[model samples]
Target chain A: MEQFDNVSVSKRANVYFDGLCVSYTVTLADGTRKTVGVIQPSKLVFNTGAPEVMELVEGECRVVLPGESEAKTFKGGESFSIPGNSSFNIEVVSALHYVCHYG
Target chain B: MEQFDNVSVSKRANVYFDGLCVSYTVTLADGTRKTVGVIQPSKLVFNTGAPEVMELVEGECRVVLPGESEAKTFKGGESFSIPGNSSFNIEVVSALHYVCHYG
Candidate 1:
């Protein structure tokens, strides 16, 4: 879907990595929490508290998931999974727009 | 309120000024359109296509409205209005989180 319907969205954004990453918290009708965000062209490591599915809405990036050595390129319409209590390294070739789902 | 409830928010973001300003379009149930956005610390001029009421959720900035000489400083919990087809200049002293309400 191009948008989320009947959802609650926080006004304040979550800014990370000196503003390289910015996202808004979205709460679905079922109380599932997601984040809609953008990552500028940069390389960054993100640590996760819960397992996450990063669904790319647009742009391109190469990600090295935890316990992996080779980076995998993911673009718009693609997604990658990150294990809980772990981290992943991502190199954004272009600005990345994504929706992050927590598990 | 800290959030917008029962709204439809677009998945993609509107990135401007080379990622200095990022915003997401939100559509209310009644079809009113708004945007939740963040502006990094910088000086920029923005033209308005429609009259706008910029509600600042957090951060600091000085703005010069169209046809004005001196700039005014505004912070969180404040708001400024711009006429349609006009423009304004803003200097963000800190990262600005805002909701843009269109008329």
Candidate 2:
């Protein structure tokens, strides 16, 4: 979808790595928590407390999942899953627009 | 308010000034448009296509509105208005979080 309808969104953004990554919290009508965000072209490591499925809306990146030696490339319309309590390395090849669905 | 409820938010963001400023478009139920954004510490100039009310949620900045010789300092819980078709110069002393109401 191009947009999330009838949701609650935080006005304040979550800025990471000195603003290389910026995201807003979004709550669906059913109370599902998600984050719509953009990651500027940069390499970053992210640790997850909850299992996450990152749905890319636009742009490109290569992600190395937990225990994985090979990096998987993903782009707009693709997605990748990360296990809970795991850390992943991501190198954004282009500005990445994504919606993170959390467990 | 900390958030906007019952709104439609675009999945993609509006990235400006090479990612110095990032904002997401939000559409209220009644069709009013707004943007929740963050501006990293920097000096930047912005031109407006419509009248805008910039409501700061956090951080600080000095803004020189159109036709104003002096820059006015504004911080969290403060706001400034900019006329349509005008431009403003803002020097961000700290990262700024804001909600922009536009017409």
Candidate 3:
């Protein structure tokens, strides 16, 4: 039988992007772990192969997709997805905390 | 030209789920908005139709799928995706913050 434990978020490390700091942690079956803070725009677009990814921001939400040719807005507490292999831009208009995951 | 503004997160409303609180907001193209806090499990499964969805938890990440019969784990700052039309369960085992978005 295999037993695994849950990973905890570290207080010292939190991901900061735009102007927001998103909290997160990574845990593996063997109990290995790591902490990360702040996901940068370059990283967001880097190797964009995963099906999910998230960025946190503070204040208002402004989303501009070059292909869409239109800006879509989002409110705090509202979550949306940015499709894979698409070029898009996002900014944290205010102060907000967002957590994202990809498959 | 159609002008749209970004949405902000309300200090009063923060979404809580399982044992963790998720920060988010929903902004529209027309500026209509609402504040929400804490996403319940029933609600996570209620809509059930979207390309992406996310959940946050504190401590070690433990993912269990009945179909696969395997448990996958995640660390803080590590994001993954949950495919559309899949059944799953998550718990915020610690005092942590997590944000989830769906499209």
Candidate 4:
């Protein structure tokens, strides 16, 4: 896989995790728009009502939703989700880098 | 409103719309991971079978989904949506800046 380095995400409240596995920002929404680092990989659980927004920044990953046997693959420029408290699994296949905002 | 400049979004496949009203990237996902800039804002219509992923970078905006009377306000670090095929309105209140990858 190719690698890109020394990139900076400009903007007052930009939350990007491409270079580092963490996002950075400061705003009123999402609690000051702070950097939310990756905690751990999770399994996609359907009907859990937990919605999440995943921003694919770099590398590849898989998103598993309900009734979905095969995990949906996504690269660094796409995004999928388990909406509004819907449970799901996010597996970082390669070096995953992306920003995310969850309620 | 405050401004942030000279920020680069690192990563070979990254889509960030800040500094300019355009986002840039290159990858396999979402059609060669191209830069998808903001064209225009539409009304947020809920239950329209359209889902969207919004990456808020800088500035402020509003997203109005159907069944909801008032438009939901989002700042420089938050996002909302009108599902797949769902029509919606995104008003760029104060120099909006963000990234979006849609299908």
Candidate 5:
């Protein structure tokens, strides 16, 4: 996505696997926070407290959230959404590049 | 910068400060490596073994590399280049968003 005005990238952070999965927060002037990250080849599960929109910006991955019977593959320019308080599993076939907007 | 066609965001890595400044490498099909990161407010020095072009994708920072008399402030949409084997100091006034291409 083109850079948005008033969005400031904040201190770096991480999740799940330490250096294998990394990301940074993009905080807007209005206090809205979005995160951008890249996940290396691996399989992992995540539990989230808020709704999230994940946009694939570079590589690709397959994800199967709770209640889903099959994982779906997402490539660059594709996106997926997850409800709040849900969990999901991901299998990284290639390096996965994504920007996640949470609400 | 728009995501390139062949660039793959790889496993996470870091330098200098922990958690405060974070980035991930983008490896290309040709084996070239680039890094994208966001820096929180702080002052830090970095040493590089290869030439680098730092592109500011969001926010701003002031940088004073070796052989430079005064630090230069760079805002979003701007970029600066550094020679190999050099060291540079950065004073982050705001969260700085950048992607570095090295050769």
Candidate 6:
């Protein structure tokens, strides 16, 4: 029940690695778009344009907030937040499946 | 990549048990839409509106065609096709993650 069945998509892309890591995007209902991202076994930095919520839907990864020194590991069902115009780093232990919410 | 990063969804729903199983919809680029379906450990009879390609993204399941008696087991990376206005039966062994394509 964490996802919807009546979802519609207008645009789509695959394996966007112009940045540090690779990820994909899916726009959900109400014009709400999200990135169902997957990170390989590597480290990457990402800057957000809007305040975003990172939801771990599958697999796991380690994340470091903008002001944090210690990176924390997150598994499925866990989530973190990043303010707009902010940046964060992630260390993918294995393959990670995540949904990035834009607001 | 099997999925797109620029995907968009305009409408969404969840756990549609009004049918034989539960599934969700997402519209992708080029006005393409798909159902991220999850089948429980049960047998289900489903009728298709259009020609559909059932892609098993996770877990495993057994499928029986309209005129077939022997069910076939399919795992991740496997797929099957159903003609439009046709009905097929599925026997889910575990939780199955699938992307149902319509054409």
lDDT of 5: 0.72
* DockQ-based CAPRI category assigned to the predicted complex of candidate 6: incorrect
In terms of lDDT, model 2 sits at 0.97
Best by DockQ: 2
Off by over 4 Å in 2: none
Off by over 4 Å in 5: B1-83, B86-103
Alpha-carbon shift of residue A48 in model 3 (angstroms): 3.5
- Alpha-carbon local distance difference test for all models: 0.96, 0.97, 0.40, 0.45, 0.72, 0.66
lDDT of candidate 5 over B2-99, digit per residue (tens):
43333444323453364456686655567676677767778888888999998887777899978998999998888999999998999988777688
Q: Which regions of candidate 3 fall more than 4 Å away from where they truly are?
A: A1-7, A10-23, A26-47, A53-59, B1-103
DockQ for candidate 3, C-alpha atoms: 0.02
TM-score of each: 0.98, 0.98, 0.32, 0.33, 0.54, 0.50
* Tens digits of lDDT, candidate 6, A1-103: 4443344332222333332233434544566766654555577887889999988766678899989999999987889999999999988785565677888
Q: Candidate 1 chain B: minimum summed lDDT over ten consecutive residues — where? A: B13-22
Model 5: per-residue Cα lDDT over A1-100, one tens digit each: 3343444543234444644566766655677777777677788887889999988876778899778999999887889999999999988887776788
- Please identify model 1 stretches exceeding 4 Å from their true place: none
Span of 10 residues, lowest total lDDT, candidate 6 chain B = B10-19
- Binned by DockQ into CAPRI classes (incorrect, acceptable, medium, high), candidate 3 is incorrect
Candidate 3 chain A: worst 10 consecutive residues by lDDT? A1-10
State candidate 1's DockQ.
0.89
User: Which runs of model 6 end up more than 4 angstroms from their true locations?
Assistant: A1-103, B18-20
Candidate 4: CAPRI quality band? incorrect
